[model samples]
Target: MSLHFDHNRPIYIQLMEHFYRKICRNELKAGDKLPSVRETAVEAGVNPNTVSRTYMEMEREAVVVSKRGQGTFVTEDQSVIQQLKETTAEQQMDVFLTTMKQIGFSEKEILDLIQKRLSALENGGDSNA
Candidate 1:
């Protein structure tokens, strides 16, 4: 429920990202009940319809399943979560690539920089140090 919303994107997209992270991180485990739409709206400081929209989208994506009278729950299918993980990775890579290109870095330069940063991270060093 703790969300730092960017004013750029739609609030519903932000909400969906929050849920996606929670599920991938195992903070919201398989079969765990989602916060009620009203509860999420209150916590997110958004309209109830926004929460509903996010939940509906998640359901359509098979990330969560809504049962009548039982509330929405995280999907029990591990493959769905894995697919989501891959999708998140692709989206992140796309963003990084776009930013690097816009900043005048070529693909090779970006890859080299990413390698260095990853090596620094693995060795517990700061890449920007």
Candidate 2:
């Protein structure tokens, strides 16, 4: 999957988040081999150092493991996956809440809006519009 880099944000953070989402979606399965830093940088139109930084940051977070000669791979630990699931959920909700707050929606209004949208979705409605 392509990394959707937001120019307004830090590239490394954005890259890391992209990988987190991919991992959480099971797109990058446990033990999946990630592209080389140079290759990923080329594909993502970024500097190799930025990609390397992203990988290193992930390694620090225990989201990926890098072998000396072999390349970086997604963590095979089940606990990591479960933790990532919760982490991704919180990140998604934080973004939603921030957007709602910025739009001047009170907490109650946002909750009500979410409930309404969820009900529509459950009833097979086109709530995207």
Candidate 3:
């Protein structure tokens, strides 16, 4: 519940990413109710308005649904959840690839490095070795 905010970005966007991670990891499953805006604001140490904006943005993205009386809930559509997972993976992979390229790693080198790391992990060796 304690979220570290990135001062370079909008808090609401960060909050949305937090929830996206939770959902992708199944920590916040489909149809699960999200914390109330005030509760989330207090937990994240942000203004309630920020939390409200986060929820509204999520709603716009079809990530969650806001009912008239009930609180916001995670989307029940399995396709949405699957898409979220794939999208998150892709974004992370993009960052990884860009960083590796910036560090002068070739495509084949990156692939080999990833394979070696996986092999090491599978053999119960230190992956960072």
Per TM-score, the best of the predicted structures is: 3
What local lDDT does model 2 show for residue 76? 94
TM-score for candidate 3: 0.94
Query: Model 3 — which ten-residue stretch has the worst lDDT?
Result: 120-129
Give all TM-scores, in the order shown: 0.88, 0.84, 0.94
Q: Please give the lDDT score at residue 78 for candidate 2.
A: 81
Write model 2 residue lDDT over 86-110, tens digit each, in one string: 9889988999999989989999999
Please list the C-alpha lDDT of all candidates, in the order they appear: 0.92, 0.92, 0.95
RMSD of each: 2.2, 2.3, 1.7
Off by over 4 Å in 2: 1-4, 101-109, 127-129
lDDT by residue (1-129, candidate 3, tens digit) is 678988999999999999999999899999999999999999999999999999999999999999989999999999999999999999999999999999999999999999988988999887554
How big is the positional error of residue 116 in model 2, measured in Å on the Cα after superposition?
2.2
Q: Count the backbone clashes (under 3 Å) in each candidate.
A: 0, 0, 0
> Could you give me the TM-score of model 1 versus the true structure?
0.88
Candidate 1's displacement at residue 119, Å, is: 1.5
